[model samples]
Target: MTPRQPEGEALPGAGVLPEQTSAASSSGRERPFSVYLHVPYCRVRCGYCDFNTYTNLAMGGGASAGDYVDTLAGELRLARAAMDRAALPPRAPQTVFVGGGTPTMLPAGDLAGMLTLVRDTWGLAPGAEVTTEANPETVDERYLAALAKAGFTRVSFGMQSAVPHVLRTLDRTHTPARVPQVVAWAREAGLETSLDLIYGTPGETMDDWRRSLETAVEIGPDHLSAYALVIEEGTRMWAQVRRGELPLPTDDDEAAKYELADALLNRAGYEWYEISNWARPGHECVHNQAYWRDWDWWGAGPGAHSHLGDVRLWNTKHPVAWAGRVAAGRLPVAGHEILDAESRELERVMLGIRTREGLELAGLARLGPHGPEPTTAHGTPARLVPVVGRLVGEGLLEGAAAMAGRAVLTLRGRLMADTVTRGLID
Candidate 1:
């Protein structure tokens, strides 16, 4: 769910973090970087969505879909200028992800041009992973071919469900048969594919959920993401539940579905790389990895958020307002926050504990005021050893990883990740 945008003034060189000056000169290249492009248009607004999206083709103020990329180009230039103003050295993006309201809703050429714009402005890293989110009903083989020709490496299809009733409940507008056809087309076009699924939709049965999972695995995409349905406030689905038109999903049901997904996908040779994502050996989504790893990236487009060092900035939400600011040659940023050291540490432990690689104990050892002291045999501060041991004993953390100086989650730990994070951070 998209939360309320934080308030802050847009100032010049606002993207710069204090440590960037030193890091930019020395070990900056050690960090991974990526770019994100947000497309705010969708054919229809789904009942369960609270994302920053619009269904109207023309929202006035020169913000129509036709010229949307041009405005995005303006933001790209602004992003470059902000980095330059900060005296930050140029680092080409290692990954670029185009996400949406449905990115495929735009013409293929327009999406291609946006990628081209990114390339021309700041060159892409060699072997850069460029990905776009697609709605199953929006594209054909020809369209998929166009994206591949534009240096696109991956396509993640939003195949929310295989059951007609579940799809109907979620207000998804694609047929079950269309998924395999699109996956075949994407494979034919030489694009690595991923399928996204939603579990625990209102009125959905365990059998219905199983069918969706089986169908997705049968289609054999390179990667898969299964997200639990979250009925956020202000969304239509939440209203339905409030009025008793639909039942709220139970945690017990969703947990069962998650376990089902993990078992099925694991048997199919897909490993869980993140809590919600699974992939074959090397097929993990690098663009998303950037977020989990706290790598720097520029997020362009309306309501998109960018991270640089300790700074987090977000663009204006309304398309019209965003376009107007960009047309005036401004950065289009609505707000930003420079994270404090404590907040940064909390975030580090929070995000780090979610991955298969686990959070490094050496890093956690540096959290105390003494900072960077020698660690114990397990590579953690002596004070934190007990906390780590407790978590390991409870089966929430992997004992082998903890012994090896990292905090990896067990399958049960994935469901209770928040508890593990608090144990590590508190």
Candidate 2:
């Protein structure tokens, strides 16, 4: 889930962090190099979703889907100006992800046109990973093939569950049968396919989840992401559960589902790269990795968030307001944050511990913001060694990685990663 509204004002050249240069380049010039485009139109609003997306009907002529491409173009121009004002140089993206209320709901050519816009504005790097999230029922072979020809390297389908009742509970529109068909289409178009699933939905049984998992794996997707349903406040699911019309999944059930997913996916030859993500050896989502690796990315489109070095910014959320601002030649940016060194270090520890590569012990040694560099026992501060030792003794950290100065998670640690992180950073 995203913050409903932006938090800080958009400042020109003001969002660049202390340690970063403005220019974005590859070839040894380390940079946060990706772009995200958000398409806020949806055919219908799903009960469980609280994303910043509006139904076409609910939008009420405030924003036109046909005008979205031009709106995004205007936003891109504004992005260029904002970065230039910040003295940040042109940042060609290495990864581009198009996400939405269902990006595929747009005309096939419109989606392609958006990618072409990215290509023209800031040339994508060679072999760059470009992805769009798709709804299973929203795409056909011709559409998928057109996207492939337009330089979309991957497509992730929103296939929440395999059972009809489970899907009905979540308000998903696609049938379970449509999933493999789309995967096949994507593969035929030479696009890597990933399936996204949700577990722990109300009325979903263990057997139901297993059927979903088995079906997803049997379809041969290159990657899979199974998230536990989070019923955010203000969402329809939240209201229903609150009114006693729906029951929330028990925590124990949730844990069992998580374990089941990991086991089944692993047995199917997919590696668990992050807590909820799995992929065949080379099929990991590059755009997502950029986030987990602490690389920066520019989020285009309304209500999207961007991070450059340590500066985090988000655009105005409403499509109508966002389009209006961009049409008047304003950056759609609504708020931003320039993360202090302490916040940065803490974030690094938090994000890193959840990944397969784990956190570097060297990272944990630094002082918060302007504090003195602490004295070191190994690569990190001397005081942190006991904490590291304690976690290792508890089997929350891989013993070898600790000896080698990294905080890789043990199997048990993966289940309670936050607990281990608190021991290190708290």
Candidate 3:
């Protein structure tokens, strides 16, 4: 998805964001802070993925894997110094997530050392959730053990599909058998496990999807995230679709797959906590929750986005460019936007409605540009009550939840979540 445009003027230069200092300075009690470290290296790029990543370790200008950790350390130090300069209270990171093309593509030692850097720089909060995204083919039993020994508590594998043809279509390197092995190894190493799956691939059949889900259920990871395939523009899959080499996935096809996934996962004892994620009771991902719940996080590495209260900042997309700025004692911030109240409310509504907890009815009052007053008996904004009623009447939202002053989505609503988001926002 395209990033929400910055409401404020673009950053003056590639240095620190102009609003960063003020956003930090005016901070009151520290909110939950998390750190995201992006490892941009990949053994091979998936055809459908558009993440900022590189397969060439030999990319010069301090972007090679040999010195990646060191270069990233420079940015972390700069981040801490920036925080100190702005008198921001030093809060231990509640969670640390390492995501990438495949973070495990780096040596286990590199991943461990980076985790050490984060811990030493700002101590980890007690029981902090430390996670890294791993590709099944890139890691082994020994590698997972090393990461666990270095304080990594969770591992999310990119097990996009269990069917051979589906994997081939996505350009995924790992075979179907590798997922169970890595998941078992992560379990043995005392780390929580999560699996990510994608549905609605070009040539995927209903039986293929069902088989994948059954295999995943049998593997039984702590958490499962089944995302519908999205063919982003400029990606290889997008090009194929444009050329008619691959059929574009229809909304109906995707919606059916989504419904099947929910039913299968739910039968397997996983409950939906968010639109795309399910967990076994308390195994919900803390770092994922941090984003949906609007926690303050600093995203380090190329092209990662960070948010501090109303301010959102992102790094330069290219690793070489990111490294050069860090080497020059700069923040490598490409640009930032300070969110207005309306943008903030829109975001709150958009993100909150996706979760199972949903949003409180009273909160909708502040979503308007002019901040309308609550006029309903239960304090829902007067204008929004009819919209909620219409959605409830249409079976898109749960009528009981609406009466209880919460805007929770029914199964149908979850499938048409964007519609609900727009109705509430508009």
Top candidate when judged by TM-score against the true structure: 1
Q: Once model 3 is optimally superposed onto the true structure by TM-score, how far is the C-alpha of residue 293 displaced, in angstroms?
A: 0.7
Which model, 1 or 3, shows the larger TM-score?
1
lDDT of each: 0.89, 0.85, 0.88
User: Each candidate: RMSD to true structure?
Assistant: 2.1, 3.1, 2.7
The digit string of per-residue lDDT tens for model 2 on 274-310 reads 8889999999999989998877788988799888866
Report lDDT (Cα) of residue 22, candidate 2: 44
Q: Write candidate 3's Cα lDDT for 213-253 as tens digits.
A: 99999999999999999888888889999999999999999
Considering only N, C-alpha and C atoms within 3 Å, which residue pairs clash in candidate 1? Answer: none
TM-score of each: 0.96, 0.93, 0.94
Candidate with the greatest lDDT versus the true structure? 1
Model 1 Cα lDDT, one tens digit per residue, 189-248: 999999999999999999999999999999999999999999989899999999999999
* Residue 156 in candidate 2, Cα distance off native in Å: 0.2
Which regions of candidate 3 deviate over 4 angstroms? 1-29, 366-372
In every candidate, how many clashes are there? 0, 4, 0
Sorting all predicted structures by lDDT, with the top scorer first, yields 1, 3, 2
Residue pairs clashing, model 2? 8-335, 13-86, 32-296, 342-369
